[model samples]
Target: MEKFPQMGGELHKIFGSPESPFKTVSDNILQYTCGKRAECIELRRKLLEPKDAHLAKLLTGIPPSSTALFEERLLAEFVRAHPSTVRPKPRNPPRLPPPASVQPFPSTQPRRERDPALQVQEHKGSWHYCFPIQAQGHQEQPLTQQ
Candidate 1:
């Protein structure tokens, strides 16, 4: 069957004769669909011009023409709803200083006292440390370091 002829018959049947209340819409739709198809492309461009204008506003920050019905509805919805970003802003906290009450760490190892007896005695080939001898009546006592 011939496509457009069948489509017109079907549209006419569905919408009624050409003089019906749906004239403009059905006529524009038929014009957008009819003819050598090249003409149909032009008609389609004209009919959906608002969609293209909305897309232009989306692409560039500027709107090429006055607000279209689609844009009006979308912006109205946005006004009604609380639109937020898909993801929240990133958080970067600052490094904090330590409290004044915190004190410094103590030394890891304790210091030891020196032993004087451990000093080297070179004169005697055998190493020995001598203490003063105390004179007693019959015995001698070694005086130790106080």
Candidate 2:
């Protein structure tokens, strides 16, 4: 049976359509692999001129064009493919500004320390009486007299 050209177009629309590069590539390493969005935009802007026609063709399998849509698509594909080789890393959070006004009083409450008791320790021959670390500003209370 002869395949219809219309069917081919339909297939491309349904299954072969380009997936969103954001989803295609892992979000964890997207920034590191592709750089910030502004940087990608700038790089796409530079790619419009096609300084090397051969390189552009080799990268995207399409001829370079000055059109904005072409540039965006090229960059999207480039970003999607570039990060696959490296494992994804967690995204770095944006730096926030420090508080404008300093508080008059600092925190005065003492922080609670974790339990300093040891579970098990072998000292020479005995296998018991594990010593616990002394907490600050507190005296050791006798649990029981030996």
Candidate 3:
């Protein structure tokens, strides 16, 4: 006796001829199985805490599961793999005050004295006044005479 195909194949036999519907159902099942298997493999790899190089090598042969259905899973896997804390630092550190090439207009405002209880903040603005600096985007000479 020969072994016969079951499930989808048997269903195909029961439903008139097995040409069109069988093809469609078989394709659908194949796609589903492939996607599920890929997801399982990926999840197992992630849970196992494999090294990056090993994971990268494993990924080379595997085809994308299903462009539409597997996207969320892929994204979740990516997020799980990367983690937000390991993100690169911002290219620009917080902008420091503009260089001494620009100066603020002179005012008779009395300088505030440091209180013993208060924390001393570095006066970034002092650089402009301390040096007779030229205004940025302006060709005008320094406001204070040297």
Candidate 4:
């Protein structure tokens, strides 16, 4: 389930970390020790691979890799060590001059005159204008013949 370092809780963090000591161990049969440290180093190398690193970074927000059993605790530790890089910062979408509003010509009233005088409307591939004439109250709006 919680396979990546950031996916699990404190108690579940049984994986090795990048900072874990990786000195060579004595190979003497009698003095030979476990390979956990070496495994830890290899795990770090794998996680640091550009693809895996990016994968780890992209998961939580977009989700939720690699070897199934490796403790994700190490990945979590990496995130812990470098908070900004691992976690995505919220980005402000470019402020658009609020969309050039296309308010349809009001059927009941005139649009206050602007420099353009008339508002243009695009239909299919052609342009047309709406001139609201208040005759008593309403008048038939015409579309220019194509």
lDDT of 4 by residue, 17-70 (tens): 433233122234324433564566556645544445565554332211344333
TM-score of 2: 0.19
Model 4 residue 82 CA deviation in Å: 1.5
Arranged by lDDT with the best first, the candidates are: 2, 3, 4, 1
lDDT of 4: 0.49
Deviation from native of the Cα of residue 131 in model 1, angstroms: 64
- Among these predicted structures, which one has the highest TM-score? 3
TM-score of each: 0.15, 0.19, 0.24, 0.21
Name the weakest run of 10 consecutive residues (lDDT summed) in model 2.
Answer: 137-146
lDDT of 2 at 66: 49
Which pairs in model 3 have colliding backbones? none
lDDT of each: 0.48, 0.53, 0.52, 0.49
Q: Give the 10-residue window scoring lowest on summed lDDT in candidate 4.
A: 18-27
Q: Where is model 3 poorest over a 10-residue stretch in terms of lDDT?
A: 125-134
Question: Candidates 1 and 3: which is better by TM-score?
Answer: 3
Comparing 2 with 3 on TM-score, the higher-scoring candidate is 3
